[model samples]
Target: MSLFAAETRIVRDQAGRSVRVPANPRRVVALAPSVTEIVFALKQESRLVGATQFSDYPPEADRLPKVGSYIRLDLEKITALGPDLCIAVKDGNPVDVVSRLEMLNIPVYAVDPRSLDTVMAAILSIGDLLNAAEAASSMVADMKGRVSRIRQLASGAKERPGVFFQIGVSPIVSVGTPTFLHELIESAGGRNLAAGDTPYPRFSREQVLALAPEILIITSMARGELFQKVKEEWMGWRELPAVRNRRVHILDSDVLDRPGPRMADGLAQLFDIIHPDLAGKY
Candidate 1:
């Protein structure tokens, strides 16, 4: 027998659950966009037999058969694909769905990349599962190098702006300390004005006005027209420092919202926004 002939191995997922998965998962299904992205990063996209509807990055992902959304998965379709393994994300995939898949004897590997460090770990773990350790290590090294450079640049900044990231306008939802966005904000030398234990917190207009953030960031999946509309609403808040100084910015939700390989790009964008003067320099 080969040195590592075991066809299946026991691995602990991010949720601290022991799962027996194929040592080399050739037929894989990604239950979340982030998970799909990681597989693509590992150069194992050909192994993906199925993926969620939101797994549209890398362009090639959109061509794959979609099992359904992360929350409302099509178990039948997923099973029909005859995948040897299914990769899910902690926050993206519903717990009940994972349980259902498990009951059906599908090997589910759950990953949670809530923070920057954990994000790197998730990539490494996925690589390990897919038997793409070298690719995963290379990807991680590149990511670390990029992040280290950003941190080195950010450390010398004299002042960190107070940034307010707006997720929703109607209910006024904002990112808190528990989410990756909050960590990205801090890492890019900006302070998240929304202070709460909740990953995403709702704040009243009065509360936001009180914080008086020096910078405003808006997240949107829509393009020019919708972005213009959202920007117009914030324009009315003339008293806000961001409004007065025109520091308000709009970012594509895909970059910041999805925790994946593109996170380095997201961090760079945040760094540029927080410290515009140090843009080309970095």
Candidate 2:
């Protein structure tokens, strides 16, 4: 056994359940896009046998056998593939699927990384489990450098705008402290108006009207009728400070919401939107 392997230790998951598996597991199947990206970052594509439907990042991830979305996982298909280990999100996927996989002794594990710190820890954990600790350490260091640089640049900004992240128009939902999106807002030096009480929640117009944010950020997956609807509706909120200031901007949902390597890029884009002042520094 290698020194890294001998030193490795297993930790309880977000649900506080104790389970034991290899510190460095081969034949891994990632059940979420984020985990898929993390595995690729560790340069362990050779060990990845399967992925979820949306694991399109790193390009080649699209070429792998997709087990379907976390919410609707195909247990029989996964069992047939016989991956040595499986990794799924704590809350993104259905609990029933995890339960079923457990009954079959598929060695499926769950993790929830809602905040930035948790995200880093999750990446390192995945890397360690994959025997890619060196990669994890390097990746974490690089990510931290980018985070530090952004904060340094942001700290010097004269004006930090208040941000209103619009997930839906009719319901008028926005981000909160519990969501990673909320951290993105803070990283960009803007105050998130919505509390997001938890990771992605619904909000009402009255709640939004009270905050009166200066910037409106809408994440759009497609640019068709849906985009038009989001644009026209928010543009109609004439009383909003963002609408009044003409700071309503649309961002790519996949790049921002995927929770992968592009997290730094997402933070940079948000920084650009919330504080155009920092753009010159980069």
lDDT of 1 by residue, 1-282 (tens): 343534788999998999999877778999989888999988899899999987888899999999989888988999999888999988868888788889988899999898888999999999999889999999999999988888889889999999999987678889989888998998898989985798889988898889999999998655567777888888899999999999999998888888888998999999999999998465
Q: For candidate 2, give the lDDT.
A: 0.78
- Candidate 2: the clashing residue pairs are 176-195, 176-196
lDDT of 2 at 249: 88
lDDT of 2 by residue, 1-282 (tens): 565444434556655666565566656789998999988888899988899887888899999898988678888778878876788898778888888887886666677877667778888877767778888988888888888888888878887778878776565666668788888888878877776556566767667767788988887545457866676777898998988889988887776777767787888888888877567465
Looking at candidate 2, the ten consecutive residues that score lowest on lDDT are 1-10
How many angstroms is residue 236 displaced in model 1 relative to the true structure, after the best TM-score fit? 2.8
TM-score of each: 0.94, 0.86
Q: What alpha-carbon RMSD in Å does predicted model 1 have with respect to the real structure? A: 2.4
Error of 1 at 276 (Å): 0.8
C-alpha lDDT score of every prediction, in listed order: 0.89, 0.78
